[model samples]
Target: MTAPRLKIFSGNANRPLAEEICKAIGVPLGEATVTKFPDGESFVKINENIRGQDVFIMQSTCTPTNHHLMELLIMIDAARRASANRITAVIPFYGYARQDRKDQPRVPITAKLVANLIVAAGATRILTMDLHSQQIQGFFDIPVDHLFASPVFFEHVEKIGMRDKNLVVVSPDVGGMKMAAAYATLMGSALGMVWKKRTSATTVESVNVVGDVDGKDVLLVDDITETAGTLINAAKVMRAHGALSVRAAVSHALLSPIAYDRLKGGEIDELITTNTIPVDPRGLPITVLSVAGLLGEAILRIHNNESVTGLFKVKGF
Candidate 1:
């Protein structure tokens, strides 16, 4: 029998990234109308028939998180009702991921709740990147293809010749030590960490550095940054420790107004991140790398029933 046709649709959250992914895959983005009704409720209409075809819907639960999340769920339901053979939710930036655990009294595990919603809406699989916590994958009963932004970051670091510098990969917090260590090992650099205490939801107090950063260029690696509190505090501490320069390689940059102000404070020389969600550099020393090709390749591999492990391989490493 002939293989099912591949169709990729996108919600309003990150249409440009979806378009770029379609470009990389050499396919046109599936036609869809995603909008709000007169009452501001989410609405989705699949313009084309997807019966017996493999369907993928791309959406990032970023700013206006609730609205985007609703759009994704509605889109998935539409595809399922349309009799699509398979439905994949391509969420480059999965929101509510930090709420995976009930850290507070009478709190909810919203991440798991979101997972259940997606599965209930008929998404057979999930394709996401750089979750706040890796264990979030277990929240889903379906297969999850969790991709990392490290390969993309590695290529950029090498291209910019930063890999050859006297570099040390530093985790902005103890919680991110594993990710920092992986980057350090892959880049053949030293590893460091910053001990910090959360002062508030939008602030952090970096207490001390765990490893030597003196006379070395420090690269702080973290999974996400919103108000830029953790990163700025870490950079300041690294500078005080006599580091030559401070840079940050964050996977997702959900920059808020305060984040832009802190980033402009110049504690960090450069901020490197992915276009998982929409990012506006505003002419700062920020570099936004496209993961479209990476995601596009994964989509193709999934449609073809192949392993996506090879995408993790960085050149010359």
Candidate 2:
């Protein structure tokens, strides 16, 4: 069997996560410098030889989204120029994914554009998790190892064990019901949803709940949380209608300043999230489960040309 040449690198998007993934994989993060110029242009320098090596660059296009994304693209281009055997862009929380299609007049499919940019930058593979839409995987011409945060949250929550927690998993909007139903099945709970209207780009107002959350502990699940308007509004309504407690499990906890304010103001009891997006609740009652191990294991499997399907078997075990 041929030996594996696994190397991981990171952009400024989430360096801490990259470090943890490197630790789990037991490999030094490939040496690279991702900096910006005076005009905020991205510059990447690969300081090591990755020729013939299987390379994975860990970068999440979170806040400062464009800069981080450009950094990733530049890094991939550099690796390709250096003759790396393969390059995988391991995006944790793929931004620009929400605009996967052009539904409006004279609109651009930004998600497809990002896909083109990555491929053009010479990314041979893609590994991402909890995409806004699973269909986004098909947006890539190359292979996409789409993963989930269920294992991370399930293991952590199951270990602690919820109390009297007959639950109703909640979707803050119609778009998220499928994800909410999946969580309900995994947790052996009921399913519910909040009908919401987007009042603004960062605000969503909950108008009604289609299912029962009354007197039940709620597990509101979604793929992302930006300003927390929708989440907070849902929780507020549930409480008014007799929800015992409103706990949340989001794949990406982008807990913005307003989100933290909402969570701190007694809008949510427990917030379970992954490290896909850097969100520090400043030691609040938020539980952050590291997905580094999950990503690391997947990277190993991909490098060895192994099936990554089993990663979901035991929650990335």
Candidate 3:
């Protein structure tokens, strides 16, 4: 099959990541103007001709989530109107994923609504990583490429020499057991879980630990963390249970001010995460790993009509 001409663009959200992806793929970043008007409206202009080209717009719906989301929609519309052959929305961090279901009364499923909006805006495909819930893929009618950050995390873990140490993978809550299990299985380590109760939106109370973590180096895995409550509280409980050290590997670290304060309490030794969204560690023991190479490779394969299943395969497993 003939590979289509590829063009990559970036919005205000995480432009550095998009540049890194272009560097990894050995392609020049596409020229585009994504700006805001004085009235707070998003304006997008595709500076280069994308006619019959395969276009990918990279944007993470992170801080100022609605604004970034609107920029992506406008970019998609611009690409479609410019006669692009295929337009893919490369969202490293998919915002609003946590609202995938209608669990409360008089509430909307915002994730589904966002999916509908993307389809309506003329996005032919979606490439995103570490969604808050797996079911969010079903919300889209178009082709959605859901990627995991396990490979990136595993590479870093290996580099940090954590593989040979007596390690235990832990989930901060029962809901994250599947992710923790995947990490434990890949690393050939023991598994543990912290049963947590949410008292409020930003507060989590870790009640107990479920498995053996005594004197073991604990690695807590979670999809995303905005408040640091779950991870910090879990680390505290694990330490109380005789854990030697506690570190967290979260896919998206959308740290707020309160999160920084909680992190300074010294419950966790290190906070490892992906650069899916822009993160400023503020001199903390936070290690931000890049997923650009993974995403760039996936983009190349997708544009060339190749399989991307190999991207999920971990080495130690």
Best candidate according to lDDT: 1
Clashing pairs in 2: none
Q: Cα RMSD to native, each candidate? A: 0.8, 1.9, 1.1
TM-score (C-alpha) between model 2 and the true structure:
0.95
Q: Rank the candidates by TM-score, best first.
A: 1, 3, 2
Report the alpha-carbon TM-score of model 3 versus the true structure. 0.98
| lDDT per residue (tens digit) for residues 1-317 in model 1 | 76789999999999999999999989999999999999999988999989999999999999899999999999999999999999999999999999999887999999999999999999999999999998999999999999999999999888888896599999999899999999999999999999999989898999999989999999999999999999999999999999999999999999999999999999999999999999999989999999999999999999999999998888875
TM-score of each: 0.99, 0.95, 0.98
Tens-digit per-residue lDDT, 61-116, candidate 3: 99899999999999999999999999999999999999988798999999999999
lDDT (0 to 1) per candidate:
0.95, 0.88, 0.94
Model 1 is weakest, by summed lDDT over 10 consecutive residues, at 156-165
lDDT of 1 at 237: 98
lDDT of 2 at 305: 93
Q: What lDDT score is found at residue 233 in candidate 2? A: 94
RMSD of 2: 1.9
